[model samples]
Target: MATKYAMLARTSRLQSVASTEELEEATTELQNFTVAAGTLIKVASEQSAPTDDLQVFVYDPVLREPNTTRKYQCAQDSLLPVSDDLWPFIVSIPEPNRRLQLVQDSSRCNWLYTAMPGDVVSVPARYFDRDDFRLFECIICYIGPVPEIHPVGYFFGLELLDDVQSPQTADISFTRKYFECDADAAIFITADRILPTPLPQDEEIESANEAPESSWSLTNFIQNTVDSIRASLPL
Candidate 1:
């Protein structure tokens, strides 16, 4: 059996996206951002879900660094031997959310997992007003061998597309072509957001006192605030 893994974003965006139109709009905006940034590999909608609650998948080809060996092992134990033959990438929202939930129960929180070096996942889409769009940097920390036995840990980073540029369409076979190519290519994530594990202890202390770098950290901030509130409530 594939060794199961779970991811928790130390920081992310968790909004109550209850409306289908809103979700669709968000999907369009996400796709536009991908094309504008030139990170799009493949995108498609979940055929089984309701149209309003449509879930889109986006795949970006990412480069794997040598340092991620251990982290990759934790998520995929047997794949290392065949790693060279398969593409290294990360899937965007909804699918990861679903995959994670398949193994464990988490609240209804929408998020995109950071692209890890050796992980393979399904990919999301769509347009929106400038004010409705914002760039977010997410640091996803992985911990597992779930149900928490023999755990290993590390961090993966992803930056949500922020800018508005003209959208470009790829041929339907784009994803297949990408997988066939043997070149070492990757869709780039923001260099500043890629935080590796074993963070300095002092950095951890300083992070508590300092403000987050961007509004993207609002998800983390909100989650922390809610936890604090719950802790303070009468037992």
Candidate 2:
């Protein structure tokens, strides 16, 4: 079975989410849940371009918010592999509140991950959210290939919350911590696209203080985070 982990973010805005109550009820009905996983995960933006934008596509299956959909629209020219030539390059605003907020409130959080295939080694996270889209306003750096940029993780399943009288449900997916690439900025990565991998091995992990020039991979990040979560669980 695939291992599980808990994602904890400090967000007053997220605390009031509508899915929390529904997820509790749905978990009870599920005899076994094959937590969200797959290859359709990746963040996109239309406000700027694939190279530059102010929105992130975070595909969490348990997500139910509907208001942030408009801001996270994908650009017409952007595509699956994220062609740098076809993508636009817009300048980012020097503001933290705007950038961080973009990540805090996104409807596409479920689409930001994928299953593990060893071919591609690294990716960068870009695209911003509508709430305060200033966090991701610079270059998107990847951890694997030298010039290629990608995202933090990949998501697989998705289910919209339904109005069931017996048990409520939480249509949510999965996610990971991302690093931004701006020298002048505080954040290192943004939610750009999901990598086609689940968890990473112990050797592939990287800490927050690690140097930027090293080769980075989503598997390493996922494995490290999952390990932390597993350790915290009660017996």
Best-matching candidate per lDDT: 2
lDDT of 1 by residue, 45-152 (tens): 222323322222222223211221111111111111111111122222223333233223211121123334433321021122344343232223221111111122
Clashes of 1: 13
**Candidate 1 wrongly placed segments (more than 4 Å):** 1-63, 68-87, 91-130, 133-235
RMSD of each: 24.4, 26.0
TM-score of each: 0.14, 0.15
How well is each residue in 87-189 modelled by candidate 2, as lDDT tens digits?
1110021222332332343432232332122222222222333453222112222322111122222211111112211111121111122232122222222
lDDT of 2: 0.28
lDDT of 2 at 80: 30
- Candidate models: Cα lDDT each: 0.27, 0.28
